[model samples]
Target: MNETKLRDEIVGLAKSMFDRGLTFGSSGNISVRLDDGWLMTPTGSTMGTLDPARLSKLDINGRLISGDKPTKEAFLHTTMYERRPKANAVVHLHSTHSVALGCLHDVDPANVLPPLTAYFVMRIGTLPLIPYFAPGDLKLAEAVGEMASRHHAVLLANHGPVVAGKTLQDAVYATEELEETAKLFLALQNLRTRPLTSEQVADLHRRFPQNI
Candidate 1:
């Protein structure tokens, strides 16, 4: 997509997510990779009202080349790009259910959510938990970089989720699927449930491989 159209798509999709209560109060960030660099939602900007023209443009090294400053969590986006060569977009969101899932103590860090649905398995696959670091900590970026190569989606301990995709739409859709599955995981707690078995999940992986 051209820069102008890509910018508009980011703004439109972000607004749709914001309007649906997927994110609020400037709590989410989105970035799309460009041939030369990347376009990122600005620091402290609300997803509901992002101005495409004012989005941050950064070089491959992540130095701001134009527009306003990038999100303080910009490292989250850059680290994914550095680690995953095929990823063309990254999304970080503080969505409610996913963050709630992160705070729970019993969930496995290696793969937090169960294979609750086929779509979840196809889009997110296994999600690792990155050790929590306070905002703007370089160590946080390090932790994310450690897992980015193998997993396209990760849950930040006590934070939220960071996802990468071949396209911006893919990233956003995967994030949404994650939040919904987290909600299902929470809702089914302490109840008799039959999540997809290992064999079933394996079949899905074979048939619908994720390529982020």
Candidate 2:
């Protein structure tokens, strides 16, 4: 999308997420790569009411060039961009269910959520759970960067989830699928739920090989 349309799209989608309670307060951040720089949600800015014109703008090196200060976790977005050349957008949210899954002691560190549904398997093949760092911690961003090249979606321990996508809409759609899957995972925690078998997951991965 062109720069102007990109800005409007970001704002519109952010409002959608906020209105639907995907994120509350100032608990999520979003970014889109640009030819010259990046457009990011400003620090402490709530997604519910983002002003496109005031969104933070950073140069190629991640330094602020205009608008408000970038999100405190801007490094996280920068890391994903640097590590995944094809990713044009990144979405990070302190979403409740995902965070709940992240905080679970028995959750798989390698892949936190199971392939409970085909959409989950296709959109978010595997969800790795990364160790926690306090908010705005660069070390956290470093760890995310370390695996960003291999994993498009990762759950931050005791925190939330982050996803990188080839486009803004791709990232947002994937994120929505992730959140819904997390909710399903938790809802089935004690119901003896039968998730997709390894073979089934492999089939989905084969059919949708782009991210895998």
Backbone collisions counted per model: 0, 0
Model 1 misplacement above 4 A: none
Residue 26 alpha-carbon offset, candidate 2, angstroms: 1.1
Query: How high a TM-score does candidate 2 get?
Result: 0.97
The CA root-mean-square deviation of candidate 2, after full C-alpha superposition on the true structure, stands at: 1.1
- For candidate 2, lDDT tens digit of each residue in 82-104? 89888999999988888888889
Tell me the tens digit of each residue's lDDT in model 1 across 118-150.
999999999999988998899999999999999
Model 2, stretches more than 4 Å misplaced?
Answer: none
How high is each candidate's TM-score?
Answer: 0.99, 0.97
lDDT score of residue 88 within candidate 1? 97
